[model samples]
Target: MKWGENVKKEIGQKIKELRLAKELTLKDLSEKADLSIGFLSQVERGMASLTVASLEKIAQVLEVDLAFFFTLPQKHEANIMRSYGQEVFSVEESKYFYRLASDLEGKSLEPVLIHLLPNQGREEISPYSHQGEEFVYVLEGILTVFMGDEEYKLNPGDSMHIFSSLPHEWANFTKKLVKVLCVRTPGIFQGDKG
Candidate 1:
């Protein structure tokens, strides 16, 4: 992330150092984390920025808490995420922009507000699997979810819950922008005091 390149480099170093300490090869980590080896390599070299979800997967395979990588805030406050001034993040050129919505200490769920750009689709990308369960509620426009061979078209106020391990991807085919509230079980993000 251009917003935090130095921090990203430090994190990459930490990941590489720990992976070496545990005597795990890149291939080993890749297979265990279900992440592409090339992407992991790029991350370790600080040449790539990954989403919080991907970072969580790496942390799980490395058997370390997120605190090992991030310097979190010391004080804890109300978990409320205000409407304004939220940092929006995207992976590379991804059309989906996300704002971390929940930052409570010791929380069990991580909720993110996703903004899907207009007329964007996930046709070129293959659905991939990850760990945990996810609940997505469409807040505006239409959100399409492709799960394996099944497809679902969700309108405003509609929601879907499914196992994250199922190969799936979210998309928007309309010309209007789409917004969704996504919450994941067995929470993976530790915003403050990580």
Candidate 2:
């Protein structure tokens, strides 16, 4: 195969990975990309090529830059996956304040860096039952995490770990913004990347 063929293969693989990460089905993504399902399948399998315009359209529908569909994963160091710089997961602007720094990507652990705005409180949603465990460490400000009938106030450098099957919720109980580092072992991001 030629060098261009190799590049095309890589791009196709990346597209497949991104699509799966976004939990988009062939039908879902084909409609969003404004392309036929057959065409998308061919492109993903590298049996066909796409124009820059088509690629751009697909990337836009996927809510990612075209360049993002080309980034290669780095070699794992001690089974830990790391992403640096402005990496946003599921880029929804509402529902919560502050920014998230990371997400679980094809790894056994989901590590999220969260930022909580002042006076912002996210009610205890429901206990999520998944085949994994959760660990949380406060980076700054004050946070109160409710687990079942128990609520714990967390300060900077405080950490907690529990089975993810327990019901839990969080709220910022301070004037300053709260930052937390949460790692969910065994990856709970099966398809909720959206």
Candidate 2: segments with Cα more than 4 A from true spot? 1-84, 89-106, 122-127, 192-194
Clashes of 1: 1
* Candidate 1 CA-lDDT value: 0.73
- Give the C-alpha miss distance for residue 101 in model 2, angstroms: 9.5
Q: Stretches of candidate 1 above 4 Å error?
A: 1-11, 34-37, 49-56, 65-79, 89-103, 118-132, 173-176, 190-194
Record all residue pairs in model 2 with backbone atoms less than 3 Å apart, i.e. clashing: 127-167
TM-score of 1: 0.67
Put down candidate 2 lDDT per residue, 78-100, tens digits, no spaces. 54445444344221111122223
Q: For model 1, how does the per-residue alpha-carbon lDDT over 28-49 read when each residue is reduced to its tens digit?
A: 9999988899989988988777
**Deviation in Å, model 2, residue 179 alpha carbon:** 0.5
- The CA root-mean-square deviation of candidate 2, after full C-alpha superposition on the true structure, stands at 12.6
